[model samples]
Target: MLPKRSISKSKPSKVWSYFVKSENGGKCKLCQKFVKSSGNTTNLTNHLKRNHKKIYLNEKQLEIGKETAGPSNVNLFNLEAKASTSKAKFPKTDSESKYSDINTDERMDSGSEYSHRSPTPTAAKNSDVNVVICTSTDSQSQSFVSQKGRKRQQRIDQSFSDISSFSEGGNKANKVTNAIIFMIAKDNCPLNITEKVGFQYLMRTVAPSYHIPGRKTISNLMDEKYEVLFKLMKDKISSIKHFCFTSDVWTDTLNSRSFVGVTVHMVCENKLLNLTIALEELSKHHTGEYLADKLSNIFRHWEIPLEKFVAAVTDNGSNIVKAISILLGKSKHLPCFAHTLNLVAQKVCEDDAIHEIIKAVKQIITFFKHSVAASDELRKRNDLKLIQSVPTRWNSTYYMLEKFVKISEDVGTVLLKFPDAPRMLTAGELQIINEIISNLKPIEQVSKEISGDSYVTASIVIPLQNCMIKQISNLSPATDIGKHLKQIILSEITKRFGEIEGVSLLTIATLLDLRFKTIHFNSPLKLSHSVMKLKRLIEESQNEIINEETIEEPTKNENTGSIWDYHMQLSSHDKRTRRENGKENNAGINELDHYFSQPLVDRKVNPIQFWFEHKLAYPVLFEIAAQYFPIVATSVPTERLFSRAGNIMDPSRNRLSSTKFGRLLFLNSLELIGIYNIQIK
Candidate 1:
């Protein structure tokens, strides 16, 4: 029998000899360019055929020579006929029309189209082997294409599964979670927002790797965040040497829940820092003792020392005032200046003559608000809308009267269209309204200027009020009712704010302020008293510093061999005695004299900035200024907290627990003041 021809099993393609194989594919040895084929040699072969034609032709000749030697030497699985046939069958089409179908009979074999690349002349001598190899390779190619599609689909599904299983502690997940929490707190969103279908869908779309936490998880996270921020805020407050607090009680109409809010203010590093320190549920009756105990607890919880409490500003409510006095001291409680001004406005509006005029204006505004046609006509005549005074908001009455005066003619025309509208104001009534607005205008402006918490409002209290009084007194009204209104406002102001300059806190603050140092004082006795009190504070501070120094024992002389040791001891004793005596006798008075002797700083200059710049020049005075400058002129900051709480206690979140509500409001306040930032780590 003839010796059997050795047939090699399928092996790596010869094209690999010119390339280096990698996990994904291989790189060409000659040009070092990558070609991806996923362990297949079709693309590798194409790379050589396109750019290395000479080498490709040489390899082809060697393969063809071996195949033609005999049928037994042929390895059918190792042939490139299938790749060539696939290329011919799926020629590259225009990119835009690459997916367009070409009509063909499904029954036809791939070999029929394979006629596009005719075989070489040498292949005809081995037609039987060539024909057999091509037929088998064609079937294998079809299976390979189908298998590739399945592998691609499997990869896509695996990626999606990986994304869905992101660990909760992953950095991306934590970042997204923090952002959601910030949004919920800042916007006062309902806790159930994360559980809503639309919110979940949005999260998934934006960050597929992040798992949307449930409402319970979000709530727990918020609690943890609040605790962390609470500790941070406490640490910050601990560094402050002095603080002024504003407190108020608000009742939520939606849930009939009562809450007390307290805000703390201080000047640190020449910047005004204010934060909401407490927003707790008021479960007990709001008596002076109950509220006082609650405030004491809050102060204790924050670790605030009694000596650090400069004062507490609140509305003129007897209960709250008594509460503050009970906790801090009788002299440590200050009534809100803006609230007092509001009272003045309210009291004057109660006059029979002004009440009738306001009543008529209210009716006209009501008609325009209810009738769309009348409102539209008014808008056409003038863009200004008639305002209705809200009893809760200060200056709202003045705003209403002022608006009516501006659009009085338009009001007449619109009222003509509605026969049932209130009668148009007479010329005399119009004159009275103008006069009232003019008189109240200066008071309104003063109220706003002093209600600020971001600047040295305490110092401006006396100056601004003095200026307002002067401005109002200069105005001469033509109408008798206007004159009566003016007199009522002046008397009310005097009755309410007449004793403000007598308060030690405001008096000293004004003295320390460069812009109005004893300049706005109407009472020489009060001014002198304020000067004496300030000098006493300075003396006390100096004594404290000296005591602290004396408490530190001097280092003992370890080696007393030198004869000058005795002289050194005597010199140190004399210097120490002279320093103590000098500070006690002249430090406070000299600093005070020096500060007052300097020309007044420009009114436009910030008082805080001025103090900071000259702290070293007037260290004793700066210390006192630090304590009093942060005392806001009004309790508006606390009032603002309640206003925000009202929005937070909307219908959807009326069932929210008081603890969570307080946390949300606290975090929101810190965010506004830039004290708290979300940490994603």
Candidate 2:
């Protein structure tokens, strides 16, 4: 009914004599069973041994005879003559002789090429003998062969039916797919990366068995991963007693889309943990009411109660401040200290005297930025390149001025070669630049020190502000511009952070820190007020603990005897001794006084570690520290999230949907803190 499949003649095997070859497998001539070729004869030999034992034994014996018969007995000319004569005598039919001519041609080609294992005497003798036996078979055997051919066809049909179950759902496939998903999330690779030619070629070369998933499939996997990680994050957050949130709104420049990024900070097991919890798209107006609702939704989604909310640190945006105030009374919101410092520095730059010198420096840097020749000439003279300052960046002006002063001489020399270049800064201007740098350097340093989320920055607010004020006030400027700059910076510092020490939240945190207990406080009234507030809180916490303990029923011993009376008396005596010792140690000492009596620890020590080590001694204070220490000094953590979001929404991936964009960012944030060690099963 159909055309017969042709078999390849290259490197003919002796096994082919007992089989009819097909595209994917071969059919045995002896018993009519199909065997998958898969490019070798191992299955064919097994079929012969299992279905036709006598033929299999004969084939094995023939192989042994060839090994025993030495090459000295094999005559090449005689073998060729015998093969030609045997082929003529057998006179094979078209179907049976199809392989006979091929075998003869192979032997001839082998002899001419001097192939190793030239026709052995036993192998030639066996081939000729088999040809005679096969030709002399009876007519009934021919009929049996045709019947077996039909059975072989039926077996081939059955084998084809089994191919449907072959799929890319194996364990190795799944493991590779999970690895690819993690790689995409960790590296922020575009979803379509799998569709690229080079990526496909790489997978084919390294792991040909694995099937790369499409973009939609990978997106779904990411969603599942996000859900798993979100639960892990939620479970972790629920166990924490206090949380401080930092939030900000960022607008993507390419698509003009806005996203609100919220990050949570807390102290857990003596370690400070921060997680980027939300990066949702802001489709509505960013009004105070709208933002308040969004913030509440985030907390509600995580199942964090309002009572556990310690404070929110954000920039001095009126809308966000009002939102936090509306959500958690006015006392729960704290202005970002770094943002306030940035305002202080920005305000100082706005002064006319300072503005003029900054303008001149900007113009000079601009000239070098535009001209290649002038820039190259300056590079030849100095290794430092001029830095350009952006208005929105903190400390950028000071950094630019600092660099310009270092390379001013080389810049002047370079400008002399170009007549059209902007004039170099005069000596008087240079003096002002140095004065500005000197005045602003302390502010820059203070900003960097306080913008940390890994340490107890809330406690450092009062002390650092005091240090900055003292540092700036003590500077003696030589010029009126320097003096004016000094006056402006001091005023800005005092105006912005002057009353920071009065805030009860920060005041208590500052006092609780062992490194600065009551040492940095200048106002006795505020200190007394903070002490009174702390005392009340500790009293309330102790009362609650006492109530909980009282509610639990004490266990009664059933085996009461006079023998345990001495143990009871010894316990009572120990209790009386402890009471007397407590009275001596706490005569007029409350928890605050006892805490202050201990020597200050080194400033480099982690306050969280200290509190954990001394929690039993100062349980109430430790509870308060847990609440207040997590309040970060700045909203920079949210700013960093927006920076990452910008990278994820690069030009090539600008069209990524908001949902996918958020998930990728969430996974990436987890990756940053080393919490994303998930395996897709």
Candidate 3:
């Protein structure tokens, strides 16, 4: 081997420098022997041979380190201060090496304490450079290294510094608690999830010192949140002059308890507010009188005027219909249009081929869901898993079938692996599923559009009704499934929605939509009747406004010449001229006439926002629009609330009290509350 240079042959390493400067410096890396920090490796080689005898690579590793320890590596230990000044050098004697190991404990105990000793004669010979170095002998070793001590002490102090910086005076802790509560309320997680060891460990990882509260504390927090939200809801509902309600009944499968969910829809500050006002558990029988009494109590509790309840939109259940008739009148009940369409979809799904396809798809989904081994195998084969559909909701079924068709090949392969696989879909059956999806896609789109809570869904009812009929008529009759499904859906639509064409409430809502106006009505007579009804509503609203103004006008002192007085005079003149023109012009001319004559609003424009923007121009008509526009075409908002309630009061949380369950649902739907408002755009 070539003569080893006093340099390491290992690759240039920043990591090796850390070890060289560590407190364990001067000790052999492999054998823990104390050696001189100087270049000579005689003692280090002997220690490695004796201690690491069985390790054959020790000799090679030592040689590599000996050759590669260059000037760049020396600065790592701050040894240049001594090495630069010393022109003369002394090699390590055997006694010095032995004494170095002997005084290890004493040196470690001394830590950063420094002492000074005069330099030797050989070092003082050339020039007085004051070279500082640590020697093995206690009598010879002068001062402890000041620079290394400071750096090491800094690192030690940093590790245990105040942990308060990890959190911003408990703001981060509060956010964590808020997120936990939201998940529990939103997903209906069990209250005891906070108690789990794994969950606690996870929290500790994020905030090691934070004390997570128990379930009871979380319950109290939620109750406080609900109270703040309820006060807000009550204020919003009481402030709005008119509102339409949707109420539906749901029975908890776990406890056999029935709940009546009531959602209030009204326009407040130009944005549509769909708030679930009450979700009361009813012990009484669901008779029309009892339900009507329950509804009356709710309105009474909220301090909403009975007359201000414009209409009640509900499912076709006779008891609900009769209850609304008892509370208001028969004319005030608007049957849910989406519920009517769901009935139509149900009628179409009665076909045998469609039924069988749904059954096979359900089986495939159940197999993977219930069997871990089969699910694992399916996961390996394809990423898309089959989704099971709810029988009560036709749109869910359509989506499930759509996904099943997309991943049929992987599903077939995965099914063959299992002994009890569902029967593979036949060619004819596959065609039927594809055809059903194509036919139901348009209907599904219409359902989702009208079920929306944010925008104006009530206005879309008439246009979608007309659009669906035209779409069904235009479908090619190439497939028998398409032809049969179309006939069934069309007949159901005409039967359920045809009579709705004359419903003055729906027609008024459609006319208020800048996108539809009177154009949605196919018949000239329907348009004429709708326009007549809207004009009457506007006139009645105008008279009410005039009466209220007249009552307030006498209380204030009159001014005829001020700027405000001049503005009032211009407004009075404008209204007087319009009234005079109304008498002089055609008998049917009103805001509706002018609105209809104006070009139809842009298709992409929001009708609710349009009416809000123009409320000042046609004040009476806008007030009337508020009454009809908030009437939903479906009781789906109330139904969706029940779905959320079901998740909250699921089997694990079945023992949860009704009051607490209702409160959680209230907070979950706070985004829909008008006081917790969002901009329309």
TM-score, every prediction:
0.74, 0.71, 0.66
lDDT of 3: 0.66
Candidate 1 lowest-lDDT run of ten: 99-108
Instruction: Write the residue-wise lDDT of candidate 3 on 533-594 in tens digits.
Output: 88777777666665665566534326755668766767666655766666523333466677
How do the residues 1-681 of candidate 1 rate in per-residue lDDT, one tens digit apiece?
999999998877767766566789875543334688865799988877775454465457555654564222212112222223232222111112211111110011233322444322221123222211112111211111123223111244443443443336443344456557777888889988999988876554344345678899788778766775675466446667889999999999887889889999988777777888888999999999999999888889989887898989998899998898888888898889888888888898889999999888888888889999898889998988899989776578889989888999989988888877878989888888899898889988988788788888989989998999999999999889988998998999899889888999899999999998999999998888999999899988887876775675264332468888777678668758878668555787899998899888889889899889989998888888988888988999998899889889998899888888988998777655543431310
Give candidate 2 misplaced runs (Cα > 4 Å).
1-175, 553-589
Tell me which of candidates 2 and 3 scores higher on lDDT. Answer: 2
Best by lDDT: 1
User: At residue 430, what lDDT does model 3 achieve?
Assistant: 77
| Pairwise TM-score winner, candidates 1 and 3 | 1
The regions of model 1 sitting more than 4 angstroms off are 1-167, 556-571, 579-584, 678-681
| Comparing 2 and 3 on TM-score, the stronger one | 2
Compared to the true structure, candidate 1 yields what TM-score? Answer: 0.74
